[model samples]
Target: MAFEDVVVGEARPYADKVVIEEYDPSWPDRYRALADQLHAVLGDTLRLVAHKGSTSVPGLAAKPIIDLVAAVTDSAAEPSYVPALEAVGYRLRVREPDWYQHRMLRKRIVDGADENAHLHVYTEGCPEIAKNLAFRDWLRAHPEDRDRYAEVKRELAKREWRYVQDYAEAKTEIIEDIIAKARAAGVEVPA
Candidate 1:
């Protein structure tokens, strides 16, 4: 999809039906499964891979899907990594140069028959990973904030949009606000 197609609050029918369900403690198992598949595909080129989204946060409601970040030693090494991933059914879909040289791969079953996951790949130590994890961790630690965010998600999910990313972006303001509060409160994720 084109960048223009990612307007906030515009849920693409293609990405509709996505919902944030109550937190599933088993999300970690799902991540582990994907991580194992990824590790077998990329082997040593993978520097670090971690569960870093809402699914990783305990008790924080999330879309019933796993979000993982695979950190490579260098992004220029995509040629070595991307092909292997595709062979295993994960297709590279998004590339962001301005955003920490991030790349995203969407995993689907067969010829786009089913949506499996959204995999975000980046070079080691990218700040975005930390930011994502921190927001999720902070939300998990602060139930009030988590509830507030969940309410925003519920309200947004009720709207129609062209893409789910649009729905995700709509939450950015509140997310950043929470992140700011966390920082102001001196909340930091353990290294």
Candidate 2:
């Protein structure tokens, strides 16, 4: 499927340049709170919820957005869970059925705070879920790679991006390299 076709509503373009901020100490607490809320909202429909991405790593510079991964019984079955999430102020932003039935929802101004978060939802047993968790765990365990990724992010942040997705896409090479290293070390990223 085409990229434009996957968006649920109007695509939000990033303003000029990407912003990478110093690690915030409050991220984990915020994640836990949100996770709790999701569990309450989703109940048995939610298989698992986890903190992923750069923000999950301690001391790593990130875009100041909390990235979360959620596994549901079937992400493509939006009717099963999307409405519940929307009631809690999460807006369905992207729905990529081709990509492991991935669905991304964004919540801005979480808990009356300016912080924003993205919840990447996928079906239970999806390989991407394991890959994301493994990547996050690898980064947390290896500071040298974490610092390297931070440096790359800072450099990328200096460039202008038409969309935040473009900036994220730019980091694919380094991300894949690190993931490769993690796999070679038996990080156990499921295929």
Candidate 3:
């Protein structure tokens, strides 16, 4: 797929399907390359740019998409950053003011069929920001939880779903349980 093929709000016939893959050691390097792309467009506007989610964990099985978190000045003020990101390859497809004014963008043509990238945007100090980072860190440090999460995702990926988001939602129970354990162990999970 070309850069233009994944443009914002475009309908995807197979968007609901989920396919998990084994750990790829090169994910971090790819993440850094994408970060470079973001920095070129966002400049200093981005407060934090990080690779999060299952793909960020070294041994975790994931849907082969890089999940990135980019926290900026004010996500609700799309005028401040949306256009610039759109100018690059990212295509903004989700906006939710009610939930920390979060936004999600995608640059799907990363490495042919083997890889893709998804950017999750949030304003500074959004609770979800900490959760995302903390979850990744916890899983990275705890092989048990990481393996469990991978297993959960592997099972969920096979279920029927109306949308890809539903597959993500199905992993919430396991995710939250793991997060709660992390917090209890003093992992500093953000509120």
Candidate 4:
């Protein structure tokens, strides 16, 4: 599906340069707090929650936004969880039913801190969950690829992007290459 079709609400153009910040030691704590909140809200529906993306990897420069993955019973069944999430200040931003029933909800200005986070929701057993975890674990164990990804992100951040998603899309090639290497090294990347 097209980007326009997948987004739940407004497809706001970023219209700004991406900002990549040096890794912060406190990122994991922030992720844990958010994960805790998700657990509280999601309860039995939540299957698993994980910290993914660059912020999850220590020493990796990132956009300062925490990226989290929450595996649930059924992501496409929004009525089961979306309302509860919204009640707790999360706004459903993206819903890509065509792509593993993926849903992305975002929380801005987390806990009064000038920070944001994305919660990517997918069904339990989705291969994307394993792929995300594998990517994060690979980067954590391999500094060479981690630094390479950081360099690529820094370079991409230098250019203007119409949408933040565009900036994310730009990193796909490098991400795939790294994941391929991870798979070659016995990492479990579900097909």
Off by over 4 Å in 3: 1-16, 110-115
Models, CA RMSD each: 4.0, 1.8, 4.9, 1.7
Q: Number of backbone collisions per candidate, in order? A: 8, 0, 0, 0
User: After superposition on all CA atoms, how large is the RMSD of candidate 1?
Assistant: 4.0
Highest-TM-score candidate: 4
Q: Which pairs of residues have clashing backbones in candidate 2? A: none
lDDT of 1 by residue, 3-78 (tens): 5432223323554565779988878887888899889988998988888777887877788767888889876467
lDDT values for all models = 0.77, 0.90, 0.82, 0.90
lDDT of 3 by residue, 1-191 (tens): 33223334654545456889899898889899888888888887888899998889999988878889999999988888888877776777777766787788877664232337788999988889889999999999999999999999989888877657767778889999999999899888876
Better of 2 and 4 by TM-score: 4
lDDT of 4 by residue, 1-191 (tens): 56778888789889668999999999999999999988998899999999999999999999889999999998889999999988887888898878899999888883553348999999998999989998999999999999999999999999988888889999999999998898888887976
Task: Point out where model 4 deviates above 4 Å.
Answer: 110-115
Looking at model 3, residue 90 earns an lDDT score of: 70
Q: What global local distance difference test value does model 1 have? A: 0.77
What TM-score does candidate 1 reach? 0.85
